[model samples]
Target: MKISIPFLGVLFLVTACSQPQKSSEAGDAESAQSKFAHSPLVEHIYTADPSAHVFEGKIYIYPSHDIETEVEEDDMGSHFDMKDYHVFSMEQPGGEVTDHGVALKLEDVPWASRQLWAPDAAEKDGKYYLYFPAKDKEDIFKIGVAISDRPEGPFTAEPEPIAGTFSMDPAVYQEGEDYFLLFGGIWGGQLQWYEDQKLVEGRKGPTDGIPADEEKALMPYIAKLDGSMTELAEQPKEILILDDEGNPITAGDNAKRFFEAAWMHKYGDKYYLSYSTGDTHFIAYAIGDSPYGPFTYQGNVLEPVEGWTNHHSIAEFEGKWYLFYHDTELSGVTPLRNIKMAELTHLPDGKIQTIQPVN
Candidate 1:
């Protein structure tokens, strides 16, 4: 675990220097009639990053449950060890998906106790929040919010979090009455492991190399949320996902910009944003008009999913447009992944259509 460097040299933060591997533990998870029409609509349970929401009209989701890593051999079990969260409703989008089991857990969050990572779900005025990026009892990694009225949830958290945000994925969007809150991308390391894991906010550069401005890569963070989804209706903005003449497209082998799983939606007058290009496993997008963004990257709606973390959540339900990602091919367990969906096609210059995963 030591990496205090003088020449840790040759190590460009392979997620803090890779070496934790193995995926032979899990065996029984592959049912639901044996999957495959596009796979992973929940094959027993091993879900991953999906956020997905449509709430009252159906399509609910909100994943992150993959707990199959005993850790000991090369240890990276905490690599993404989520504790709970399982809201899975559906009325369409391939139909029949309802596993509303435990909509929030990690000891019911009193400030989170584990790495219950990558989450997002929203609905206001009538209430139904759920947004987490866990690890609190001083394990750091903050960003919380849970309060439910049902979307298949018993949610009711908020022991203290969502104050000045920290790191990890936590998407939320709701234009018109305003409530943005997109979280960070310290997903792999840089900005000096996001300032030595204080998780970004000044004076922490070069945790390895290559940051002469990866298109103003400030380590993914965004804000705007005050109607009591938990505070911070302003003062937070570092999003940089452009590149078409708009600029700021870091080009890390180019999967468009801004890594980490950001996910915002709206499609007619435009305001897309979709993230998770972090270390490039796909799921890229950007094309804003509001909801705070200079966005424009416009490409890859969901392409490279095998696993290294590429989160998602985009809805539509009865009218279609789906893309809730996650996959390590049914838990060969690259950090224990699962959840997958495909079906997003739109054209006429608004652009979006690049799906490929369904083995």
Candidate 2:
């Protein structure tokens, strides 16, 4: 109809009429998901430096909580009452979860006189064992253990620090018939066995002493464990060194930043050892065929994405591999860290692909 229209009527038509934008919007969403498909899962968290393990069809995350008092003082003190050890359960598929408060606390353990941090938990023979680091009155970080019948625990502590070498960050793993505990800080490394000696009853040995350099050389060790939490062999020996292609990781710039929170994982015939590069805030990994040997640096597996640090763990859950790690919330090196989990897929080649953040 070629009828003349009033100015107001024309204005109304112009405001209401436009090209359909549905197709463009749909295209944008598809592009986003396609980009994010290779990325890690994102989440909000109250914990940091998380170590995860699945038990009885459920995943348990043991991390250090930022107590309010610790935040207020702006001091990562060596003593505190609010260690904030908690347990959470996630049901099959996806659903809301619940927090069971304070799985292990400082006062709960008889020998703990200070800060508790960096906890890792696992189950063996139907019993759950939590390995964590705490301080004595002297403020030195040492590793200890707690045991409970269930994953969510009101756990009981052993008589003393489980196996510590004036260090923190305890990681335990079961290799074949042996349970090996690998832990250390920048000072170096130590490995412990869960079998064979009388921990309570003293042992008579030679009073001979070793040189300072000889003592310092005693790190990056591996040993076998029996039913008892005692070393089945002599002191741990340094051996783990190998390349991503199963070659020896030689001493050089490629071998720089090889110390700190080193944890090993075995997948099929390859062994993956992940560790944090000190001060760089990046996570690097090495590969080996054996748990104890030369592991070649695979380079940084993951790094800070959008102002987040790459200090974390890559673990498998329900047949799917996931990277579970932490990041700072406040800008410029904030201590208030948050946990993140993302799915990890292995490439045809040996090296692991770096993970990206998901929306």
Candidate 3:
């Protein structure tokens, strides 16, 4: 099912009709649904691992800019060989998307060697911050920060990667005046190589010698961001995900355990932590009382998509919530992915209704 195509230079915009139509009856259930047709927000180029946010009343997306490359695919994500990032924005969900060319590039990062992976963005004190994961000169994944005055940016990178960051998919969540960074990914993302805050050379996972059924699942991490918003204020801590009975979800439970792409959002009084079930290809979530959580596994937010990886972001726009994610629909290849969006609903009982990607 994996097929690659030559890069296309032409830029095409696919307008989405994602707005919910008004109904005659007050609070009609049918009217509450979005009419969004699941399709690539942009088709001229490939983009993935969408980190969407609503800034200044507009929907801004920070996604990994995917390009066709000669690198062979591997479990360590050797094939994703992305070199840059582009910022996209829309007036609203399912609207015309604007691609603000080349927000940041690999060549521009002084400390990074290769692979500009999934990124997230935040705004503070009239400045925009772009948080991204890239392999440094040592070939280990480290999170870095870029700054800009505009949401869509020609961002400038810091002189070095954040001191203690050691993994991929950097997602930033802010509540009131506090900002937290949630991150980590295993396998090709190389999160497994680090233990006890340092690299454990030649470490292996379940496929090596560890028994999946008995080994506790690897968990994503969260650290408070200092007021400057560029570095972690404290040491990273594991965000444990447990089952209904309070036991940690085991590594064998691929369908529910965290793999990568950590995201956090708040609804009413509860914090929702969602992530990709890497190999299983599901986007699942858990609910916790706080941002730093011992969350209880809830359920899947999205079913399997058209590729081996599923990365997503959730944001509220104009009183409705949407799930932004990526799939290989355009290239039919795993690494070359395109971003898409769908309506996400939180039911009356606080559980997310599972979303099925449209064909």
Candidate 4:
């Protein structure tokens, strides 16, 4: 992966911003005093939509690198004009975090145009793969993969995005020898515009013309990845989230339906599928006996935070579980957000205790 000198200069600025502040710095002292469990993982630069994984012996976080922009805010998320990604790592939860400079950027992506969103990382055959969502040159969101020799990456993107992929928030879940891409988002994320595996022309979301109460809720998609992990092994399929009556969650049931940010993890013999209830501002989860699931809605894992958007990833490290999420506590602006993590607890009955974000 070749990086230009100009990009290296930008990395220098990013690194400077990521440096730990001296105690004499008043702002740093003040922030340190008030820091709590839900505080931003890194105060230097904004980050959100954290997709955390325990690679090797350390916890590495792959999150959207949020930047301040003049783009007007809207329900379509135009204000979130992020254009790159950065990887952060730590020895353990609540410990010091090291920001690994730019892993992938829009200028380096051949097929991407703008809006580099949430990303996830996976390791196979001694190589690390970073999966991210970005708007293609045609302005449609597509998932892409970048490769790195190490978990903390200055990754080189593939010449093109993975074919047969759309929408955003690509979360890769590995089980045994198989890897599956779990992805989708509504509204600005563009999941609503797709129908029958293709983008529907002149499509409108529920707020525009579609009746939420009568229509089945849009679902997140999952498809197996071939050994190379760059392309889908088969056509993507919807992972159903069902209500107690075994009915598919309806679009109107915003409190219990899938919104965006799909993450999968296995606990015991059950597969847990968790996601953000976009407008509802909750991190909810469902459980199934298999990876490809008709999961039964369990309950929320996180409550509303300071911001409008909610995204999260769950992983167990060193016999303890943690839920990595983001809120706008630092900037207090919807688009400029930060990532956070809290210890998560699962009960004996397989239910997750709803976590209320610290004020």
Candidate 5:
């Protein structure tokens, strides 16, 4: 039997943004070498925000288990809990997977105290590290790290925040020489940018060049981590605020320009940073030659499909890179999402081919 949990609203946004239009240069998508071989039919797995690490030749997918229960209507006024962590193990060849049961429960942690959200897990040395965002003392959200000897964790947390309240949805990367963590930007009202008091004609608005008037909008941010991968510190360089063509998308009305669900991986000489755009359930991408990027936005990679929001994870396994994401097809057009996968292809010119579900 399959167990279903809800609470994934933005997890499938990449699919929402990745709709395929027949390219003038291509044969049908099926004829393309890069399309996914198959797509799954499942629902409410909330297997959103999926992160996989191959352990001893097995791939495990860990996602927040925000299970809902039948309770009195008066008690229904409650926030979801990240109390359960679900694990899925994939079989070979067909990539068929079996649900591995709840691997960890938040109520099992004394300090966790409240809501749990996105989690990214990786294996280092002989241990598995899981980094996630959860509520701290004042009920404010912060990122924290946990360590376990196995991929399916009974993880233990450190005494402090690995990344501060300003950070969430972290993707950790270790290049040849250093370690880094990428996260969504905080809406630091004071950090916003603006044009001079003398508004320029034809410009019609602030032309300060910083997108979103970084002074007033939420932009994605990154921090460098030490070799130990614990502390989150400001990098030596200036903070990166997501901007489109030197103009900031700073209006409160335009906050969706910021990237969410960001992860960076370097292939050959290029680094691909994938993210979900806005809450419209769309996914977009950018590319950079370096980890610390002057990345050029490549536009939305996935658009909403069926009823699913667009969001995804890119992973390389057994020499193949795949996009792992979720969709809302079976549960109609709501937040209930399911797990899906597709093959990812990179071209010689440093451009990545957009991924789509197998028909």
Candidate 6:
């Protein structure tokens, strides 16, 4: 749901360059908190990119299920709207969410159609993997893994797609028994920032940047699933977006690559990597010690939502730390995003703190 990097500088653009003034009603952003609090958090429908999960103790939320299309004039084709995903849950920390209907859809995904975008939910061995992204039936754009032993789903897809995955947000991080997943960038060009040129898969135009020996083919891949978690048990590599003297961020310089949704967590021992800093509006991060990194960007934690792309996810549940994300300021357009959340701190010696986007 991102990709505007007007030339990489404003931190990396995504609301397709802005001019969007929308959001003005705060009087009743759902009565100002306490229905459960923290974020536009979900009022009736519209959601996007979130993907959190604490599971059995509650904090679920699979997001990316915003719909509102009377055929608006976004002309950029489908407006990235979406067909289904709703799976809120909550129960504690800021409490009250629960909406679990239609866990995964796009007509039940046979080879996919439309463009279902962003998703992630893992549990492994016991079963519950959702990793999504659609546009197949030859329209191309891979990424799919649906199985479910119940994480609120009628989910069952896996008839294909994921074999070598093409692109589009599809997070999934397990670590311990090893899971990984995380996907590619967009921006009309599946973006590769600087020397790695992209956008030519589901089609988008005019690129012309690949060099540094093709900069590891542009970066951002991961892969390592298997256990029948819907395929790709290995062979995906790429993550090396380095530079603090480690080198590897190509396209010539100005660094901070990886212009996609690409999340990934794990606080204490390090390894953050957040994303979505394409054309501007913020939402970045970097720091590394594993999980295929070469990272080191470390900056911009978020601050850019009033419509124009801002996909996110950074859970912690029961002990605090939230930050779902999305903002059209309530149907302010920008694909009518919605779904928000705030309250994410950390600035002691650990980093992260720039949130700003509440009611």
lDDT of 6 by residue, 131-188 (tens): 8888777655677888888787767888888786666787888778888887876443
Better of 2 and 6 by TM-score: 2
Residue 307 shift from truth in candidate 2, angstroms: 6.2
lDDT of 6 at 294: 68
Work out how many backbone clashes candidate 4 has: 0
Per-candidate Cα lDDT values, in order, are: 0.69, 0.56, 0.84, 0.84, 0.55, 0.68
TM-score ranking from best to worst? Answer: 4, 3, 5, 2, 1, 6
Ranked by TM-score, the better of candidates 2 and 4 is 4
lDDT of 4 by residue, 1-359 (tens): 22344654566576754332223322353563464346668766788999999998999999998886778877778778998888888887877788778788899999888899889999999999999999998888999999999998889999999999998999999988899999998888888887787888887553443236757788899999998989999999999999988999898998988889999999888899999988898899999988789999988999888778999999889999999998766665667777889989989998888888853
The TM-score of predicted model 3 comes to: 0.89
Number of the top-ranking candidate, with TM-score as the measure: 4
- 81-155 in candidate 5: lDDT tens per residue? 455666776745244566766665666544566656667777667777777776666544567777788777668
* lDDT, residue 333, candidate 2: 31
lDDT of 2 by residue, 255-277 (tens): 33444566777776898888765
lDDT of 5 at 72: 25
The TM-scores of all predictions, comma-separated, are 0.31, 0.70, 0.89, 0.90, 0.71, 0.31
Displacement of the residue 160 alpha carbon in candidate 5, Å: 3.2
Write model 1 residue lDDT over 1-359, tens digit each, in one string. 12223323334334331322223443343532233336667655567788887777777878888765564422222656668888887777766677768878888788777878778878887888888888788565678888888767779888888777776677888878887888876433222345433444443332333355443555466788888878887777776666788767763544565656777888898888887765667877878787677787877886676656677788777787888887766555477677877878888898887787643
> Where does candidate 2 stray beyond 4 Å?
1-45, 70-82, 92-95, 187-221, 229-234, 239-256, 305-310, 330-333
Task: Point out the worst 10-residue segment of candidate 1 by lDDT.
Answer: 13-22
